[model samples]
Target: MRPLAPSFAALACLALFSAPALAHFQEVIPSADVLPEGGEVNIDMVFTHPFEGGPVMEMKKPVKMGVFKAGTTTDLLPRIKQSEIDGKTTWSLETELVEPGASIFYVEPQPYWEPAEGKYIIHYAKVVVDNYASGEGWDELVGLPVEIQPLTRPTGLWAGNVFSGVVLKEGNPVPFAEIEVEFINDASITAPNDAFITQVIKADANGTFTYAMPRAGWWGFAALVEGDEPMSSPEGKDVPVELGALMWVKTTDMSGK
Candidate 1:
């Protein structure tokens, strides 16, 4: 009986060590969330575990990339350039903002096949950049198949501000959707354990979720929903698709001069 007890303890340890990996966020981050006078905004797109800040997955050229402003969407796919980080493929875009309005930059990346999860991942990620400090047009939707419509202004936020948004699938609210939140750790912070890597929250009956930013950096909120159709894996097996509507927000710390 003593030997059996030791074996049981070993199995328990293994289970703890093999806990599920942290959440993956498709990051579409801008160099500056607010442009005081309208200038060139450099945007970086990456797919990786944001909290751990490592093991960056290879990102293929996005199928669609554009900017929505003033009730119109302009195709910016031609501006996208292939880049690399830690030898993994990423993307970058530099666009000039000359108008006084909020610009919504969005990317629809190619589906990534994840063998560990036995599924494909497609994250339609977007971020809001205010040009000339114009407050209008921050709440306009980019019309992504899945998206987060920000109830609060996505830009010019201070640390500790509660950011809120609603999960939308096909332009309709998805009741009680599951959302994963993560910070883009820049090596200045370390997680105490795996549990702290990714924070999970659920939307309310109206499909709205909110979280307070504790630090000054980029934060990602991903509303995950299962796709309606299954896609074939590279191995020719039918696998489900995980559709994520991700939005990026930046927070700044208030300092006394």
Candidate 2:
């Protein structure tokens, strides 16, 4: 029994070190994924480890922020309000819906310097809200440097439904791209291990991937790839830039009558 205990301790140490690295996600969650009829939506912008739900990183004013609807894009940067999440800088925005259609909100954040990784990260994050039961144009592409065009309608989804998307970079499909998926822990779900915290999947040769939502909540999918060129870090050394195509989708529970 004594020898077994020591052997178990050694295995635990190895498990801790051998687990795959956890991935970070840029969250653009809204107060509601579906806009009420003629109502407003509150949006929260933050850079964080979503599943772990702590150590929120500082996010600067976005390089670009806007809403796309009915084939026109409106700049909403001035409406964004700044606040702190866990003492780290965060942002929010509010917008009212005037018509029935799809509303796509996007943010191109300034390149965030990650000291631990010795690189810069720029995750172009976006979320879609269906307005008044009209699912119009939920799949519109905003022409981001990297983006996920949802094959599945991003809003008004139900738990256990499968969500699918194509990972695109510069309007071209990225074959077999690596994607990381995590759900916001607002429900306080405890992960049994590190692997349960962040789920990973890969796009197929055509840059498409699918994930089934096991629970009703907000889920983020981030397709990650390296940029073509390096950028200068704050310390004046050139560092690799990681471009992430991130999207947030919400799912609901089936109503019990």
Candidate 3:
């Protein structure tokens, strides 16, 4: 007979070590959700496991970066500056908010090769910033290949309020879309386990989903969908691409009350 199989403890350790990592979020986080009078906007652009807050993956220069406002789109890629997070390449930008309305900033990052998943990932991530207290244009569609159209206002939200949106693919609603919600773990909140690291939600027949944020911080919602076309990987194998439509929102606390 062959040698005895590994013991239960040995197998358990092997399985645990071989488990895949958590989901990756393409983050487009503005320093603030609401720009006070005479305030400017600064943004952090990164790809990482938001809730775990580390081992940030490298992000190449974005393919597209722009702001949509008042029926016009302006290219903002020129303002981006190279940076690093946790020894991984990242990017940042700062822009002055001259107009007194909501500006939607979005980015299309270059295809990232994820070796563990054996696929390329491209997330079209965006965020809304209300300037000078003007609440207009927060819901405007920037016309990305994939995106989340907010049914609820994306800004000026309070903690514990429900955030809702419809997942759209090429301007049409995607039924039963899968969304993963994660918060930037800046406050040292620990998850009980891997399952609680990222909260998963699914859209209904009309592609609408909602979640009540329990904390005051920046939250990232990613709508994941399979790409129609496949891309060739470095190993010369054709692999599926994971296209993500991601959005970021911030919630405030009621401490002053």
Candidate 4:
């Protein structure tokens, strides 16, 4: 005799447990974190699961992109060019850095609809590039709606260094905000389990959090907060929106000559 079919609830539970929980990271990575002599800086922006390093999501043209340096913000939206990775849409920009200070590159992408979560995602991502290793302007704020203000210098760090930041929403500290950390896996390392993919932490009462980098690579810190109002989904339904303020920092190992 044939076995009885499983109930709908049982199948749903199985599917939920079987799927891996991979956190989404909006990556705005520069070719070099510290340009000693001030040269061209190539920036790549992608929306994907950074730890797994694949299954890239299509990123629409960003609404705004620019650089903040020396108390000024320069628009770089027109310089951004469309690209594709694994058949998914991405973006890149190249700009020459002539100054001797830190340049904070930022991008505000269009809202992406995620049907599975029943919410839209809008990640305001940014990174810092220190020209001539001047070290100044590394702590300047880009004034994003939801932003991670770095307490530690965002560039020229050794691999084992601790990176700290404060979560702010609309220029105000967001106490106990949740932050997700992930490394840009180069396919050289493998996670032992799904739980090891994304590292989760929460800010303190003052909205500050810290994490240490174990290996030499780029790491992203995303401070997540829910939007004030719901947005219209593709299906014409009202859904919640997830606002992620992401920042990327690069670390290198101390090598002997």
Q: Flag the better candidate by TM-score, 2 or 4.
A: 4
Record all residue pairs in model 1 with backbone atoms less than 3 Å apart, i.e. clashing.
none
List the global CA lDDT of all models.
0.93, 0.90, 0.92, 0.94
- Tens digits of per-residue lDDT for model 3, 96-167: 989799999999999999987889999999999999878788889999999999999988889899999999
- TM-score, each model? 0.94, 0.91, 0.94, 0.95
- C-alpha RMSD of candidate 4: 2.1
Our tally of clashes for model 4 stands at 0
On a 0 to 100 scale, what is the lDDT of residue 33 in model 1? Answer: 95
Output the worst ten-in-a-row residue range by lDDT, candidate 1: 1-10
The residue pairs that clash in candidate 4, if any, are none
lDDT of 4 by residue, 43-145 (tens): 9999999999878999999999999998899999999999999999999999999979999999999999887788999999999999999999999999999
Question: Candidate 3: misplaced stretches above 4 Å?
Answer: 1-3, 7-20
**Candidate 4 Cα lDDT to native:** 0.94
Please report how far candidate 3 places residue 140 from its true position, in Å. Answer: 0.6
Give me candidate 2's TM-score against the actual structure. 0.91
Which number leads on TM-score?
Answer: 4
Instruction: Single out the weakest 10-residue window by summed lDDT for candidate 4.
Output: 248-257
- Cα-based lDDT at residue 105, candidate 4: 97
Worst-scoring 10-residue span by lDDT in model 3:
248-257
Residue 194 CA error for candidate 3 (Å)?
1.1
Cα lDDT tens digits, model 2, 1-257, are 54545678789888877866657788898888777675889999999988888669899999999998888999999989999977889999988988998889999999998886889999999999888868789999988999999999998889999999999999999999999999988746999887798899999999999999999888999999999999998899999999999999988889820
